[model samples]
Target chain A: DAGVTQSPTHLIKTRGQQVTLRCSPKSGHDTVSWYQQALGQGPQFIFQYYEEEERQRGNFPDRFSGHQFPNYSSELNVNALLLGDSALYLCASSQTGTGLYNEQFFGPGTRLTVL
Target chain B: DQQVKQNSPSLSVQEGRISILNCDYTNSMFDYFLWYKKYPAEGPTFLISISSIKDKNEDGRFTVFLNKSAKHLSLHIVPSQPGDSAVYFCAASGAWGTDSWGKLQFGAGTQVVVTP
Candidate 1:
């Protein structure tokens, strides 16, 4: 089975610009979550989408938003991007309520470089 | 505040030796923990996970130990191999019934270098 897949392996945008990264969850998965990994830091939770609605969100600004399609695919949109927005955007998918932890399967991630 | 912290930024070990990676969390609500390994140009892959109910969980050469009282967790790789050389991360989340729904909070990550 194909694992989670993300679009635009890499992206480069200027400040105040907008960017949209796409992600397709793993086969048979229902939930989609987004994370940001900075240099020397672990992946931080951005938000999670279930049933086409955001269930939980992390300490992120309103500039960041996302949507989950009926096919379980997701898109992360960053408006008015800042230099600090440059980081690896990772997309992970998992089934909701699959016991505890709900191990997430991640995609290769989209590297966003804001210059 | 970083709820999960991996103090060790990197670890070096000889092949066929034991490698222990530690992680500590301040959030008592976190009950489920997981370890992930990542290679350059790739995303973190789930290695193993443990719930609050279990103190220890093992799979093949990798084992994870959880200490709820101390709010600490560890991942042990026995007889480490060169291929295991990668960045390892510790993550945790609250159960489903609670407000947290698989929203994992991760550590700074520990890079493991297995030298032959």
Candidate 2:
């Protein structure tokens, strides 16, 4: 079965611009979460979506938002992008919302470059 | 503040030797910990995990040890191979209840190189 898939392997956006990155969860998975990984650093959780609603969010500002469709696919939107927004955006899927024992399957990730 | 810290930015080990990666967290409420391995241009893959109730969990050649009192966890890889060289990250989360649903706090990551 196919694992998680993300669209537009890479993206380039200018300051004050907005961009949307897409993700298709792994087969048989329902929950989707987004993370940002800067060069040489570990990923930082952005937010998580379940049942089409954001269940939990990290310390990110309001400029970051996301949505989960009925099919369990997800989209991460970042508005007013700044140079610091340039990073690898990763999408992970889990079988359940419990988040404790559930192991997350990650996509290759979309590299976002804010110019 | 960085709740999770991996002080060693990188490490090198000879092939067939033992490789131990360490991680420390300041959050006492973190009840679940995980270790992930990542290659360049790829998202991290889950390696192993241990719950707070348990001190150690092992799977094949990979093992995870948790010290709740010291707020530290470690990943041990035996007989390290060149293929095992990659960046390792330590992640932790609060209880798995409804409110905290899998929110993970990650460390800076430690790069491991297995020299043949």
Q: Give the TM-scores of the predictions, in the order they appear.
A: 0.98, 0.97
CA deviation > 4 Å runs, candidate 2? A97-100
Candidate 1 lDDT over residue span B69-101, tens digit each: 999999999989999999999999987677665
Per-residue CA lDDT of model 2 for B1-116, tens digit only, reads 89999999999999999999999999888888899999998889989988899999999889999999899999999989999999999998887674444788899999999999
Docking class of 1: high
Worst ten in a row by lDDT for model 1 chain A: A95-104
Residues A28-69 of candidate 2: C-alpha lDDT, one tens digit per residue: 999999999998788999998889999889989999999999
Prediction 1 global C-alpha lDDT: 0.94
**Cα deviation of A67, candidate 2, in Å:** 0.8
Model 1: residues with Cα > 4 Å off, grouped in runs = none
| Per-residue lDDT of model 1, residues A1-115, tens digit only | 9999999999999999999999999998999999999988999999999999998899999999999999989999999999999999999999976655578999999999999
